[model samples]
Structures are given as structure tokens and as C-alpha cells.
Target: MQIREARADERDALLSVHRAAFGNTEGEAAGDTIATLAAELLDDPTAQPVLSLVAEADRELVGHVLFTPVTLADQAVQGGYILAPLAVLPGVQGRGIGSTLMRAGLEQLRSRGATYVMVLGDPNYYGRAGFATGHQIKTPHEIPYPEAWMAQELVSGALAGLAGTLRCANALNAPEHW
Candidate 1:
């Protein structure tokens, strides 16, 4: 197994994994939109610094994880990230590809000086990676799934006294067609 930055040629395979992983909830059409948005967002200058990691086995893309710039308002803090669209091929789920990608991604972000990271995902899964509910920190986003909205402070005291709306990258909020 090898984990590395995804190359341009691997985008389609990665999209296939994403579609298989999220298609049930997001629908097949949504997968195309997700892939398109990911491609467009990757080219944006402001989002260029974000990281996209892919896990491959035998030269086949098996899983993917994306981290983009995010901000928390209370501390006027701006050096964090948002984890989105983490996906693994259905056949490979529960075999640790997702965990591996997440671990590598978080370590990379911390090494890159990211102060914190937020993810909207399953608490049971993400909590194992050091994520805690945003409610514990009084995060400003009134997310419907409270347990799903989690935050991890990379640096000690990174989130101390911080409480604010998490600002996602423009790409996420942009019109679907963009």
C-alpha cells in the first residue's frame, strides 16, 4: 500500500471511489457534481495550499481524503482546515484505508503548521482520530448532527478560548455549476 499526493491522471479513479462511497446518500448524479467541484476547487489559487491525499494499492486508487482552508471566528484564528469527501472503495471499506488516509492527512496538516482541523463525519469513526464534538468547544455552526461536527486541535491549546463559525472554502459554498 502507498499513500501519496494524487496526480492529475488519477482524478477519474478517485472520483469513481467517491461515487461508490457516497452515491447511496448523495445519489449518482451528485457524484459527478462532487467530482467536478473537486476539480474546479483544486485549481483555485486561494485553495491551492489545501491537501488532497490518495491511498493506492497495486497502483489502484483505493481511498481519498481532502483538507481545505477553514477559519474559526472567536479567536480571529485562521490556520485550520476542513476535512471533506473522505471516501474508500466500498469493497475496501472497514479494511483501514480510510483510517490510513485520515492519519496521514492529519499528520501532514500538523507538520504544515495547521492549528486545528474540523470534520463533519461520524463521531464514532472520527473520534478515534482525535476529533471531538464542536459543542464541547462551543463552535458557532449550528449543525443538525451535533455528533457529526467535530474538531481536533493539533497544537496544544490551539482551540482554547476559541468559539466561532467555521468558514468553509469558497468552493463548498459556490454555485453547484461553478
Candidate 2:
């Protein structure tokens, strides 16, 4: 399998991956919601400078992950982003496609001078990717499970002294999303 930055033409395939990945565990509506979130985030202007990556095997797109711009309420921080809606083909879920996409996307973000990356996901899953509970940073809306909100510094000590509500792209600032 190979990992690379996603192309504009792969938008539909990328959304489908989200649907399939979420539909298997969540309901179809849940899948559709996440897919719509992905689509909206891609078009949201505030989400510019986003990092979207895909995993491919046998010439078929199998996995995808996205990181969008974010900001701290009081700090003029640069290179802060949030990871959302990572997806992988249901048939290949057990494999490492999702993790590979995340690692590749994070590396790209770091190369672009990202200071830190945040994610709202399973603590165990994302923890393996270097993210830790991020209570120091806040989400736009109150998150029911605070433990799911995680962060990782791209630069050493980047999270030091950082504290405030995280303002994400408009599409992702909703209460339902959190």
C-alpha cells in the first residue's frame, strides 16, 4: 500500500471511505453525518491550509485522514490544527492503513511548521499516534467525553503555556460534532 496527499478528483471516493468506515460501526445516518462533515470541511474557506491524505492499495483508495486549521482563544499560535473523521475501507480495518495515513499527514503538517495537532477520537487509538489528553486546550463546544480530546505537539514543548478554547473551522464548530 502507498500513502500520499489526496487529489481534488478523489473527493467522492474520500467521502465514500468515511461513509463506509463509519457505517460499519455507527448507523448509516452517523456515516452520512461524518461524510457531510468531511465535505463541508473541504470547502470551508477557514479550513484552508488543510492536510488531507489517502492510502491506496491495488490502485484503490482505502483510507483517508484530514487535519484542518485551529486557533487558541488567547494565543497567537501558528500551525495549530484538528484531526477529524479518519476513515478506512471496512474490509481492511484491521490493517494499518488508517495509522499510516495519520503518520504521513502528521509528518506533512510538521514539515509545514505546525506547532501542534489535536484530535477528538478514541484515546487508545490516537494515543498510539502520539496524542495525549488535551484538557489544557478547549473545544468549541463542551465535549461529553473530555478524554477523547487529544493533542500532540509537532515541536518539542509546543503545548507548554498553551490554554484556551480551540476555534475550529465553521463546519466543525458545531455542538453535534464535539
Candidate 3:
């Protein structure tokens, strides 16, 4: 398996992966909502731009990860991007595709001078990737799961003085999705 930047024409495959990887309350496929979130984040003018990555095996796309610009309360110390949504095909969930994509993407961001990366996800899962239960930051829009809000600093002391409401891309401003 290999991870690389997603090509412009592979949007649909990414969407399908999201659909297959995420599920609704009943444990059934509920991808349309997240897929829409992905599309909106990708296109929103207010978004700080994004980096999308895909994990491919045997020439088939199996997983995806995205990073979008996030604003911090202290404009001077930008929160960098938030890893809003990460998806791996249901059939490949435990195979480490998602982890590989995540590590690669974060490394690329670090190499690019990123200060921090945040996410709203399961602590156990994100923790393995160095995510911790502390952001000392706020979201631009209100989010219901404060516990899920987590962050990992790429630069030393990046989050040391960071605090404030996080302003996410327009697509991720929806309270319902949070």
C-alpha cells in the first residue's frame, strides 16, 4: 500500500470511501452528510485551502484524510488546519491505511512549517497518532462534543500559548455536523 496526494479527478472515489467508512446512529451507512462536508470544505472560499491525501493498495483507493485551515482566537498564532474528517473503506479499517495516510499528511504539513493540527475524533484512535485531550482553543462555531476536540503541535511550543475559539472553514461551521 502507498499514500499520496489525491488527484483532481478522484473526488468521487474519495466520496465513496467516506460513505463506506462512516455510518449513522443505527450503524448503517450514512455517508452523504460527511461527503457533503468534505465537498463544502474543499470548495468554500473562506476555507484556508486544504491538503487531501489518499491511501491506495493494488491500484485501488482505500482511504482518505483531509486538512483545512483553522483560525485561532489569537490571530497571531494560527491554529493551522483541523483534521475534520478521515475515512477508510470499511473493508480496510483495521489495516492501517488510515494511519499511514494520517502520518504522511501530518509529516508533510510539519515540513511545510505548520504549527498545529487539531481534530474532533476518538481519543484512543487519534491518540496513537500523538493527539492529546487538550486544545486550549475554541471552535468558531459551537460544537457539542468538547471532549472530542483534540490537538497535536507540530512545532515545539506551538500550542503553548494558543487559546481562543477556532474558526473552521465555512463547510465545517455547521453545528449539526459537529
Off by over 4 Å in 3: 24-29
lDDT of 2 at 149: 91
- Model 3 has an lDDT value of 0.82
Top model by lDDT, which number?
2
lDDT of 1 by residue, 1-178 (tens): 8989888888778878777777755788877676766765677666658799999998889898888887655556767887876888878799999999999998999999998888877899999989987444433445566778788888888877777666566676563421
Per residue, candidate 2 scores C-alpha lDDT tens digits across 1-178 of 9999899999999999999999989989989999999999999999998898989899899999999999988788878989997999899997888888898988999899998999999999999999998449987888789899999999999999899989899999878899
Prediction 1 TM-score vs. true: 0.86
Candidate 1 regions exceeding 4 Å error are: 24-26, 134-142, 174-178
For all predicted structures, in order, the TM-scores are 0.86, 0.97, 0.92
Compare candidates 1 and 3 on lDDT and give the better one: 3
Q: What's model 2's overall lDDT?
A: 0.91
Clash pairs, model 1 backbone: none
Better of 2 and 3 by lDDT: 2
Candidate 3, position 159, lDDT? 86
